[model samples]
Target: MDRALLNALFDEAVAKAQPELAVTRFLPAQPKGRTLVIGAGKASAQMAAALEKAWPGPIEGLVVTRYGYGQACERIEIVEAAHPVPDAAGLAAAKRIVDMVAGLSADDLVIALISGGGSSLLPAPADGLSFEDEQEINRQLLASGAPIGVMNLVRNQFSTIKGGRLAQAAYPAKVVTLVVSDVPGDDPALVASGPTLPLKGTRADARRFVELYRLDLPAAAIKLLASDENLAPQPDEAVFARNTSATIASAALSLEAAAALARQRGVESAILSDAIEGEAREVARVHAALAKEVAVRNRPFNKPVILLSGGETTVTLRGKGRGGRNGEFLLSLAIELDGVAGVTALAADTDGIDGSEDNAGAFVDGTSASRMRAAGIDPLAYLANNDAYTAFEAIGDLFVTGPTGTNVNDFRAILIR
Candidate 1:
């Protein structure tokens, strides 16, 4: 398959998740009192723009997005903030969003456009919790190599806007949440820690995860998690009576769009899973084994088929390398498939920014390792140092798409000819 075909597949996956296409149908009927738009994540700006076009009545509120991911919206205010880490702007936005939803009458309406990266973008510290404490906890979570769900579970305990607190503040008012899921199993609550959705686990559950990941949380954070009054509204709470949530974009639909394109091109497509997780390098090794098996024996799937999978993966940050999980996965995959011919693959985050880098992800093939070696770069050393960005950038294989204004987690395609 040509490289253009791979690009086409990735583009199709992203196009399928566009809020312009997904939000219009999910919009609720015109409200009686006021229509308020509020959200936070990488896709909040695009979603706000889409909401402006779809809602019949006047809709005005605030939404926060990552830097450079902002889209112009006349009615809804678009604010840019730091992502994967909370900055003053994000903390301020979170505070404003919570205040916006407070004291609303039952006649009013709240529309929440939640997506990936919302967890860090909306960092409203609960009672007695400080912004610096939340930021430190976020840093710990991102570096802990824990699953996204685990990270969300622990962080939400310290946030006032997360774990359904936003909706709780919106109380009698009807809250409609349109989510672009970036979490495994497409759990709506897990997306951006479910600002408008109900709280997940109990305080005990949060403490358990903190211990499991061995997160060195601040003493205030630990004390706050122990308090029962701070727990966000549960599923059975009356606060969620009028609150409704829908996952507008997800890895599942995005993968199917790519598979459909592959079928139209006469290439068999197989979807492995949409919720794969764990360490990036380990995941890459498994994918490499699958590619080799298909190339050698075609046991699970026939030849000339593209194996597709989606879901977020974690990276254990032991080395001070500049690379995201997708790039790390590809670098490790390249090493494992060193001499296995007839195999090429691409892995990228749908958000267009993998980790904090500009590139979405990278590509790999059988000769990738040798090519790096020829260029005086040791594949094993790069992989060990967690420097996939440098390695792939040196070889001109990084997939740079800028900000696609969406996040469906990771998309990986392995083509075997």
Candidate 2:
């Protein structure tokens, strides 16, 4: 397939998997009592709008989203906050949400809309810990090169509302959660750090993660974790007895949708894996080998095939880089492909924000390196410096779709013919 057609197909696949469309199909019947909405993520606001349009009863509550991801809703308040890092706005919003759900009777219904960014967007630190303590620890964790699951496990241990504590706050209120999963395995507890589900990890596990990752934590944080006064909610609590949650959308679902689009275009498709995880560059190298194998020998699959995969990938930041995981993966893929014939690939975060960069991700074809060389650029040096965004932008190949209003994780597609 040509470049334009491939791009169109990829974009269509992402659009089709948006939470606004996906959440509607999984929505339950109108509650007999009052409806209370609470959510957090990059897509929380958009998800709230979807609930408003679908629900038949009066709905009121608050949802926190990343800055610039807010959508208008009449009854459901949309609050903007920071992501990949916590801020005062998120801390305040989380407290408000917890308070709102408190004292709710079993007759009331609480519908939680959760997605990728909810971990950072909802920052109710456990007692005796400040938001600054949480923020500093989050920064250290992000720079520590640890996987998302590990990071979230640590996060759950430090928060009051996460790890099923939110459900506890709601007491007997019936809580139904609609989640757009961005983590591998689609574990409901790991998504947004499992605010509405029982936390499976323990304080010991959280401390082990910090030690294994060598995360530099503040003295206050360490003290708080050691104190029984600041311990997170336990998993065997009665408050979790009536809570229920479901993944309405995920990275795997998005990848399958993309593969279907490729097949409809007369191109065969295969999903490499829905739960791929590892170092970004190493994952790119593996994908490069698979794409070349399919393109040349068609061993795994025939020619004119699209290889699709989804899952969160991590990038170890050794250098001062200006790219996200998807960009790093694309850069590594380009170097490994080395102008291989009849293969092109796109790697991008479905949320439209890659790490803290402006672009969603990037695209690379067989001639990508040559085109960069012709433009007096060096892909390897940029890759070393973690500057994939600059390299792709210089070649006019950076994929920039600002805040698609939904997130399910990363989407990767390799087309070979």
Candidate 3:
């Protein structure tokens, strides 16, 4: 397996899903009156920029994205905020977004540029719940290893501007949402907690998750979850008549692009799944098994084949070590492979920031285990401590791409030769 070739394929996948390349074509038609472009997510700034470039008419609005993911937009304001964990900046930005949409006329339009990471990007706590309460909940959800969908369900219940509330606020006006899906199944409701879409999960579901994760919540937060008035608006509500959404980019598109690149290079390619979800290390174990089969038995396919997959994975933190799901997956796979020749892989987040880390992900070849062992790094120890980042960094295998201006989900590619 050529390392350079593997890296090239990953690059193609990331580039193909960029907001600038995928957003403009899905933009809604210009409205007759004022157009307010509100959004939140890692790719929202880029999405806003694309919308501004395509729309000839005057546009005004605001979008909050993770700190350092902001892109320049002349008409729309781009506010930088924290992600994976909510902060005061995100709370304020979310409040401002809700206020900006209030009192719209029937002829007005609201274009929501939603993407992955929006849940944490917009954290407007409900009436009773405070921003600190939302922040604590976010921290718990991330550390609990809950999938993105479940996390969003809990997040929306406590948000003042999520779970269709934005659309409810813009009632009587047209609301069109353009999304870059990063969650499994491409559920728009899970994309940034469905700010402009109807809620699919209920407060009871949120309570169940709180118990499942053993999270200690504030009394105000618990009370808000049980209140019917704070729940997401019903789908049958009259406000939904003018609400609509479209997925501009997604994990499937990026995975297909990577597979096409592999085929062009004379290698057979297979997309295992675009919605696989589980604990990061466990997912890596399954992929390592498949790679072993292809290399040793050639049962799945002949030699020189690449397997591609995309989805969000979770990491149940049992240690204080610093790492992301992508790195943790690679480290575990390297240990499982144990220097098996003719197998190499790369796992990365399309957004270029894996879990709260600086690197997109990491690379692991058959020699990865041996190299780490030689460097006095025990794979099992690091895996147990959730320290994959340091393990990969020591071997100079951390793959870092600052910010890709787009996010679909995790991308994993395995080459069996």
Candidate 4:
């Protein structure tokens, strides 16, 4: 258990999966016509910069990202905005982007760079819906423990630019989208509410998600769903005929990069899955079991194996928790391991922000509990209140990598020796 080695491995993994590096390989050849770039997400600014450097022709556009994620790009205007929750800055930017792409000619090229956090950073309320109304709904959905897919389904219905409408607005223009997927399935349509991919979810799916979560919605939202006028953009629509989208990076890619680093250091690694989801604590328990199995039996995999997984997980906030989902998961996993020898693990969000917390995530080794107790922090009590961040902070185990400028969702790697 070399902590320095673990940290270096995590850093290398993130570097390999960064948008600037991952996006360049997926970029299509420069189109013959004018390239109009419009994007929104935590990584859009960096992705836009990468595009400008790689594209041979002139590229002109505007992209919105989280406040601290901006990069220098002369061709693409970068706007910083609030994230996780929509604000006036994001609302105004979304409107401007929508307007910027509308009424382009057939020869023009529209490249939409989308990634995580775009849902809130590119907030554009649908007709008959106010920004405040949409903001309120976003807050409720986030707190309701709804999965990203369900939340995006509801968001797409209420958004003016989402669900392929952005591409629709640029009708007759060739649209090419390069996405860094943060969703579980890596579905382009689900990422950033499918602003470029064709929207396939029906009003029924949106209604069911709301009902399933028992989320209270405004009357205007309910009315909009009941009416047939504001459905999500469909595949059969003319706008999708010339549109092309590619998932440039994903959580699995990050995990694999981490594994490669581990292997180079004489460590064996296995990717459990890239789409693991569910309650954060429950998912931790499952991972803990697998780790114990590998450590004890050495059956499915030999010792010194690292189990990797990615994808977004949720937390059904029941207490006054001051922790992100990754922290919660690590706390639960530490409890389950209970000082089991030769096991070290890290769980973090690829975007460098985990569930509104400042830290990227937390790390837990076999002695994690011992270290916390030595610092006079009660790990169990903190876990009960979902305050894993405080617990990890006391022991200096919290991983803080301020705004990596790209997002591919959560990355979890467990080392069993």
Better of 1 and 4 by TM-score: 1
Q: What are the TM-scores, per candidate, against the unseen true structure?
A: 0.98, 0.96, 0.98, 0.96
Deviation of model 2 at 386, angstroms: 1.5
CA lDDT, every model vs. true structure:
0.90, 0.85, 0.89, 0.86
Tens digits of per-residue lDDT for model 1 on 158-207?
88788888898898999999999999899999999988887568889888
Query: Which residue pairs does candidate 1 place in steric collision?
Result: none
For candidate 4, the lDDT comes to 0.86
Q: Which candidate has the top score in TM-score?
A: 1
The TM-score between candidate 2 and the true structure equals 0.96
Worst 10 residues of 3 by lDDT: 225-234
Reference-based lDDT, residue 96, model 4? 93
Q: 2 or 3, which is superior by lDDT?
A: 3
Each prediction's Cα RMSD? 1.0, 1.6, 1.2, 1.6
Clashes of 2: 0
Instruction: Name the 10 consecutive residues with the lowest summed lDDT in model 1.
Output: 225-234
How many clashes in each candidate?
A: 0, 0, 0, 0
